[model samples]
Target: MNVQRGSTTFLKVIIFLIGFAVLAVCIVLLPEAARRDAIERPGDYSLYPLLVCAYGICITFSVALYRVFKLLTYIEKKNAFSELSLQSLEVIKKCTFTVIFFIFLAIVYLRVHAQYTGDDAAGPISLGLMGILATSIIAAIVDVLQKPIKNVLNS
Candidate 1:
C-alpha cells in the first residue's frame, strides 16, 4: 500500500529522507581523509559500498516502520485483521530480519575500517550499530508475538 498520501506518512518520509542525506554525506566525505601512502588506511573508499548497503537496509526498515504505522491505522478502522494487514505484518517481520542481518554485516565492515585505518572510530559506530540491532530485535519480537493475537482477534 502507498504510504505517501497521509500527513503523518509525509513526516515519516521526510525523516527517512533526512537520514539518507546524512548517510550520503558521511559515505562521501569520511574517507577523503586517507592519504595515498597511508598504510593503515585502506586508501580506497571501500567503506562507501558498505555504507550504501547499510543505507538500503535502513531504508527498507524505515519503509516497514511506516507501513506498520499505517497498518495500525487500518486496524483501528477495520477492527479486524484483513488479509492485507496480515501480509503487511509478515513483510515487516522479514524486513526486521533483513535489518538485523545487515546490521551485523555493517558491524563487520566497521571492524574492517577500524583495523585498516586504526582510527579508533569503532566505538560510536558500534553504538549506532547496536541501536539498529536492538530495533530489529524489538520489531521481530513484536511481530511474532502480535501475529497470533491478531489472527485470534480476526477470528
Candidate 2:
C-alpha cells in the first residue's frame, strides 16, 4: 500500500515538534527539583542518578526527533514499504528501549531518593515512570509485530 508522503511527513513532523517541545520544557523545569540536596543521610545522594536519567530521557527524545526528520525526508522520495520505513522503525525501536531504560532508571532514583526524605513527589514520579515504561513496551511490541502482518496483508 502506498502511503501519502506529504501527509505522512506532515504528521510525523508535527509529532516530532511536539516531542521536542516537551523535552525542552522538561529540560527547563527539571533543574528546580534536581537542585534539591539529597544529603539527608550519609551516602544518600540519589539525586545524581535522577539528574542522569533526566538527561538521558532528554537526549533520547532529541534523537527520536532527529530520526523523525530523517524519516520524513527519506519517505518524500521513497515508497512507504521501502527499506526506509523499516530503518526508521529500527531507530524507533531503539528509542523505545531507551525510553524503557530511562524510565526504570528514574524509578530507581525516585525510590532511593524517597527513602531518605520521604518526599511526596517521588511516589507520583515513580508511578508516571511505570506508566511510561508500560506504554513504551506495548508500543514497541505492536510496532514489531504489526510490520510483518501488514506486509503479508498488503501482499
lDDT of 1: 0.66
List, residue by residue over 1-155, the lDDT tens digit for candidate 2.
35676687677879777886867667676675655554344465556677787778777767776776776676666544556666666776787678778878677667666777777666657686776867587566748754874685468
RMSD (Å) of each candidate, 1 decimal: 6.1, 4.8
Model 2 residue 36 CA deviation (Å) reads: 7.1
The segments of candidate 1 whose C-alpha lies over 4 angstroms from its true place after superposition are: 1-43, 153-155
Looking at candidate 1, the ten consecutive residues that score lowest on lDDT are 29-38
Given candidate 1, what's the lDDT at residue 134? 85
Stretches of candidate 2 exceeding 4 Å from the true structure: 1-6, 19-23, 31-46, 120-122, 149-155
- Model 2 sits at a Cα RMSD from the real structure of 4.8
Weakest 10 consecutive residues of candidate 2 by summed lDDT: 35-44
Residue 145 in model 1: lDDT: 59
TM-score of 1: 0.60
RMSD of 1: 6.1
